[model samples]
Target: MKRKVLSIILAAALTGTMLAGCGSSAKQETPAVASDTGAPVSEQPAESSATQTGTSGKQTDGKNVPELTSEPLTITLWDISTEDPGKTTMEEAVQRFMADYPNITINQVHQQNDNYKQQLVVAMSSKQAPDMYIHWGGGPMAEYYKSGFVNDMTEMFNTYDHPDFIDAAVAQSTYDGKVLAIPFGGLSGCDIFYNKTIFAEVGVEVPETIDDLEAVCDKLIEAGYVPFALANGSKWTGSMYYMYLVARHSGNEEFDAAYTQEGSFTSDAFIWAGNKIQDWVKKGYFPDGVNSLSTDDGQDKALLYDNTCAMMLHGSWQVSGIRADNQEWYDENIGVFRFPEDSEAAAKGVPQDVEIGTAIGNGFSFNCWNADGSVDQTKLDACYVLATQYFNDDAYNQRRLDNGTIPSIKGFENTIDDANMKVVADIFFNASNVQLWYDQYLPASVTEVHKNCMTELFGLQKTPEEIGQEQDAAMKASLAE
Candidate 1:
């Protein structure tokens, strides 16, 4: 969410949109500080810059405060968002940041997430990468860093006030020994957003197991309600169910194995889960015409808000959207619950795949373009300072929470206000087992193959055995590459 804001700044700077919406570009502040000689490098203090104030309160030794230059620097950044001009909380944060260091101007840019991904790949491949661009966590992140377009933030991690600020997020951003990007915050992806009024009228408690869930779905269907809001046409949205199953049935070990090796997707754990999903579809659990619904077209919202659909399984990020679209509807009816694990799986003491609470959203990075090696370290330092400080700042975290988001920063959990959301928070913080999103961990190519296998299974385009064999082949090809 914050990435959307930061990217707005980046885009505006790079494209020069000339929109009156952007506040005036902030001027650089020069606070005089001493160097080894009687000369002053810049007006900003090395330890406490015009923009970045030390959170430690006490400046300890070995904290190297590099000298800064007086030269004004502008770095282009990219982000994606649904917010209109100037109202974005992140845009507000950028405005506030400008107040501190007048010299460093961040031209925030914005784009649609899907479009940005397509555009960024082309731009980076052409060596026209922005100074900074927001990126997702997981496999793509690792791949992009490997492609040599991202900066490693390890040094910034050590220098920041809260060394642990990025620790939880690092789980997604770190790949094969390198930390490629800063975590904006963590996200919970396996929540089942439900309609409380429907549960009450159906006289059904929240389902505690897969059998229990199936029974409830039957009752809901009989009661003239859609049991689940699923948008299969959007493709990736359908992947959420697969991830939940993978988390609950196979647990992290299976998920991690599948991630580390493509062959794991063909294991019994995934095959059984795929077959079960098809079984559920035959039972008519998902909404009617879901196969044709686009995920981004607000189908999930319509199912929940318009059609009396009982549940929509998605990330915590959707909490705000549900509430925003229909608060009275949400307040009187909406609730969120975890997906039920199979009783057999649970009996074996198999862990529920609970998503980590307070996880960071995907993060953006400062990609400096030092064509002549003239990029100022101080400017880089300033970018790190802004990224680190602003991300952990209470104001930004509170804003995210107000918008129905869970923050990943330490001690930032109290920002949530919804009672239903509190349950999700509890599930996340106290979960015995937590796993990253399945698609998040796999290479895009392999992830797509699995999705195709799933589609074939759901549509009965392939037999169970055929699906298994296809999955095996997909894994083999991915590993071969």
Candidate 2:
């Protein structure tokens, strides 16, 4: 079944009192009264657990007893992506949690992604962050941790003996060598998805190098097809292409170095890559008016579904959505390819870079606790079981695979029915090196600047040199931070 986004709309008019009471924001104060006694202040638990089979597929050994003792415990938890008013999938998941442990009542709150970020900032400044809430780990989470908005869960994480993921996702969730939060899952980026039917129709073959790719694009154009469909208006969507080019041209090490080591965007690697992209744009390799494309408006999909564009480079998760939207097109015509090997560039044009699985999308970063920086031993114990168990659960792995999401867990394979998606999966699983999204590793504002500059370059509004200067300045500022 297609999992729909939760539609529950929360009132943005949040009060300081509500934020503290629900444990949904960072305004919570660890009070001395609550810490000293270690006695039950209220009768309710903050979070409830479910009695599902363990990751081993055996019945739980019954370690925790679900009893609602008269202890004053309030857990402020918030969830974004549960804004849908009709039927909340996560709420249903939370309900299952309630069923196992009837004593704990979650003071559950919901927010949209953008709004949640803004409000979370406020909660952090006010020192009232939720006992536990969903958060992105890298930048924002790091900032919040520095501000003392959330408690460290390192001990809790170690106690659980978290399983090793093939992609080493644990490291991404860690900050400055401290394991901050549990990673829910991660996305593998830059897999080339193509239409076999289009290839056959245009008599073009999938290329394996920069030159080969250019040759194929030229053939597709001569046959009256847009070589690729890129959505620049959505911003990040367009960065997918630029990142691939950079990784293929400059190589992962240097490209990554630029983010860490202060360097000019006009450096040899940057100029070479920027010039290549501008050249492609000038040649009309991408679809016309791509700058105005809306990610949600079906324009990008039309490029694929209507057979206007031949390929798209994105994370593997889109396979299920595309296949569900047009099964026939996916079944017969679609194919997947890795970024063609770039022998000339410093970073092997190869997609994977083992340093850290760099890719896009957010995942769980940290687990929170009650006010006064106290962990309800009972709840913490339950949470440990849930996180580690879910990480390796076969059913959970299967569900993600069914959605065309490639799991980094060792045994989880792509189970999508489409041959194209399966081929993509093989390339992903076998990739000797897998780097996470390049943009993901950058400071958010700088990544945005890169995206905007790439778009302007595509539109011929910015010269290659001009883009190099602006992007170099932005990266310099970010590095200073």
Candidate 3:
């Protein structure tokens, strides 16, 4: 419970990156693809409710879905969709599912984002694990699967009719060559959501390179605005900065090598990411006690709301959170922009366009087990129905779109009319590759190390080398096991 990373080997190889939790690297890289139509994933639909083929050769309609029991049953479903649009969207889905299946009831639990992984780890290690839960698929999900905390949904997925999810989303959800979880969360892209009014007032253009970004930060600071609204209490917020730095400095190859142990975390890119974060801290580019600001308490948004901060580099879901809280303010101020490229690095042939975020936002993996650890067949079928049928159906997706989410399914572009959402979708659509977050990508023990390192790195308590060395040590320990 002290950390999210557990130094143990999964039965299969590990894969993932920092998102909302901690973890190690993949033994093999999953190919990043877009839609089946080879179009940008952001241009994809949420759900068509049209006929589609399952992974297995068979296709299915509602009548062919495995029947649920008539006996009264209660199940718990956990996720970090604690805020609006996501929260309301999920609640509605569960309501619809239960309305149809009158004998079954789902207890949907919305956990705070900051403590979700740690709490889920504790739940799985004890008797309190939920029947089904949302997770950012990567090494930690692999850890959960290997530790017997989750069911292998491959067979169920293949047997059920699912939305034609983008190839990248499916690939991210699959682990060790099998479908371990369903991609219920939308295609998540992380970018800097800035106050357009601030830029206009400051007489600076949106940055297109790291250098330009720094210049903009300098001007923002001169204007007495915090350049970035960072609530590192969630840790993953800071991890985005580090991941983007690594991506721009050396592209995905460096992180990929570090993950596979083919290279070191002390690689130039990692070192650069660490030092750059520290430098930003010293430059007063961030707020005081940035790490102490709790994202769950809306502390970061508070900064944005008051105009104390001009920009927030965060997940696309913030569109909904911001819009839900103060629609007028969001419409008038907030705008989206991808993390700027490293122009100098690009000159050296280091591709600066690789994206850092999630193709699969959060995956839903079931844990339907009876006492003595035997599988609960009846509950598994019902849970799978909820996940595939209820969660990703047209109704569920329309709510997501209305809330401004672009799911990883093809053909839904017309539903998104928000200017901010359009920019985010375009970023995802144009990205050649998408990297999952490190906290979600690494194993438990390594994730703890990574998250802690981000805190220390941004706090300037540890040098980049020191942080990288610690991460490397954690990675080696996990790999050895």
The top-ranked prediction according to TM-score is 3
How well does each candidate superpose onto the true structure, as a TM-score?
0.80, 0.76, 0.83
Compose the digit string of candidate 3's lDDT tens values, residues 289-396. 999998878899999999999999988888888988999999999988899999989999988778988887888998887776678988988887788767876666
* Candidate 2 residue-wise lDDT at 378: 55
Q: Can you give the lDDT of residue 77 in candidate 3?
A: 94
Give a tens-digit lDDT track for model 1, residues 1-481: 0111123222211210000111112122231232332122232223443233333332211233322244687777777764632138667766666655667687887777645655775676566778766766665565566455666665555444432332455555565555556665445545788888888998899898888998999999999998988887756667777767766786766656655563356677777777778888888888666667877788778877775688888878777777787778778888888888777877788876555332557676666635553444565666665664554344555566667666554444444558876877777766654555544444555555666766676666776567666655655554454
Per-residue lDDT of model 2, residues 1-481, tens digit only: 1112211121111111000001111111111112122211211112235232332322123222222333444445666755322125345544544454445566767777534665765555455555556655555555445545444555555433343454345545556655555554445545677888889888878897778999999999898888888777766666676666666665565565555444456666667776787788888888788789876566877788887889887666667768778777677877787777566753535443332233223444433444445545555554544444433334444445556665554334423455665666566556555555544455455555777786787787987678877766766665444
Error of 2 at 214 (Å): 0.7
Question: What C-alpha lDDT do the candidate models reach, one value each?
Answer: 0.61, 0.55, 0.77
lDDT order, best first, reads 3, 1, 2
For model 1, state the Cα shift of residue 451 in Å.
4.3
TM-score, cand. 3 vs. native: 0.83
**lDDT: which is higher, 2 or 3?**
3
Instruction: Locate the minimum summed-lDDT window of 10 residues in model 1.
Output: 13-22
Candidate 2 — which residues are off by over 4 angstroms? 1-89, 107-110, 113-119, 135-137, 161-164, 346-361, 367-386, 390-395, 414-418, 478-481
